[model samples]
Target: MANTSGNAYGLTALCPIINGHTNDSNPLYKAAGESHDKEVRRILQALPLNQESPFANTDNTYLARLFILNDVFFQQGNDFKRDQLKSKYLCFNSNFHGELEPYLTSLWNNNENQVREIWQHCVAFESVSNANDFVRYIKSCQLTTTLFFNGSNDQPVAEQLKALYVKQMFSEFVLTQQGKSAAELKQAFKYFLQRVQLNDVKSPSWKPGQTEVAL
Candidate 1:
């Protein structure tokens, strides 16, 4: 738990990690406080990169902010953050609490049943319609490859069906108001390509000669 004094906006400044703060805004009489503040500033200067927030006033606030920070870093496109969140996306059973890295890696590599099961169970994801169509298109490719999924996934299949409906809906239901932007469609296509390139999890449809060519 770190302590924070009021900063410029009086937001209990948590960032730019520091101990005691400054502005020349306040006049102080104690030389000891000044010395302590200088030492704190020195420590902060020395540990810029790895510094923690000094205004995580409560335990819950600290945890909440930490989670947000993790999300920010993840979304910033950092390789480490991408890997970390991808681990969260591809691995990690939210219901079962335990050591995640090994269990998830094992499940991803060795257990398609579990991986598909976990994947199918996700309900909170943004259902990107164009991407979903592209995924189904790839899945429909008759290359000797197959991504085995749980047979019990009727709902998941329905969801895929709905995504198909969504892709078509833009044209049919929306009366040609306009479809997804070209950039959005390209991003969807790129995402599908990336999925097809899973290293240890070779997808059959991904192999050459299995799918149709678009001229």
Candidate 2:
């Protein structure tokens, strides 16, 4: 499947938004007359970005985004007939490492409330009551990926983050320890290794979606 290129998976889903306005009294929506598409977009926009993104909690998620597609674009210089969608769709695209099941499971497990809030406006999402249901619903909405671009090595996210941490720390060590005595340099290198704990990928490493290094 095009969705699987090595250990990476690209997920593309277009879930139809409900045709009517939400009747729920949630403050996130304008109960009087807000369209479902508008509510979905509002929820997505209010979501935290970067390290605080819901995907940041989802294991192995390299990238993900969401948007509302109200209609199709007309191309070919207006010679060809323009097409229009019957309904608006909540478009979701994700690029991640490892199998789709586990990745989606992690997403549902880690960000269930956010997922429910955003996807509730989409048709049939009410059937998603748990992780398995969420996975199944997403699969039903999934489109076959015709082409998936793999830009990085197919390594587990933890390993990749650890490698980056090692590189940065080693570079800093090289710069700061310059011109030290041989013994001092050797001792400093040992401390650096101990601090980095290169054998452990879980700690002293970059967090997923982290933008700025913590002081």
Candidate 3:
């Protein structure tokens, strides 16, 4: 119940980053002075954005992000003791539809290479060889989502995408069909319904992470 609010799942994980330099033999580690955490950040920054993002291919993923956690901030003039993290961490948070296991499986299956590259610097991540392994690894690093915000109404991503597609197509139809004859308007309306495919959520629907209108 901690990570679930209806059908939506909010996942948060803090995978401990290794406190070591990148292996010299690795092609990605061109600089001998680069740390594991720095290389992870560089790769994250180079990831494709918007429609081309890795999460775009990940099924049911509404949103996902990754970043390195270097340290906790100090509250100035506070009397409480300061917190010092034992190691830098890789922070991953994702909002998605369906169960955690399924979503994690989709994530690993779709972006295995990217996942391996980013999480290789994290502790115990080398053991993650498949979807099940990835799920277990994530759970080990998972933190309870105490206060998840349900901004997506717990709807499956396919349904939401279809809704967006229908709305866009209908709006365009309304604008373009102005001043048509009654018979012509009726014909156009039939075509609009066919094109929108109100019952079919797969075809002619908005692509996940789409940023522009294609229809």
Q: What TM-score does each of the candidates earn? A: 0.15, 0.93, 0.93
Instruction: Please state the error at residue 121 of candidate 3 in Å.
Output: 0.6
In model 3, state the lDDT of residue 66. 91
Off by over 4 Å in 3: 26-32
Candidate 1 per-residue lDDT over residues 1-215, each given as its tens digit: 21111210101111111223333334662433543234333433442121132211111111111111111244564455353422211111111112223322333444333323222322222231333432332223212212222222223222333344334433452353248788877776566446444232333222111132221
Q: What is the C-alpha lDDT profile of model 3 across 112-169, one tens digit per residue?
A: 9999988998888889899999999999999998788796588999999999899888
- Candidate 3 lDDT score at position 208: 91
TM-score of 1: 0.15
Per-residue lDDT value at 56 in model 1: 18
RMSD of each: 24.4, 1.9, 1.8
| Model 3 residue 68 CA deviation in Å | 1.3
Model 1 alpha-carbon drift over 4 Å, by segment: 1-10, 13-34, 50-215
List lDDT for all candidates, in order: 0.28, 0.90, 0.90
Itemize residue pairs with steric clashes in candidate 2: none
lDDT (tens digit, per residue) of candidate 2 on 11-52: 999999999888877766664578989889989999999989
Clashing pairs in 1: 143-210, 145-204
**Model 2 local distance difference test score:** 0.90
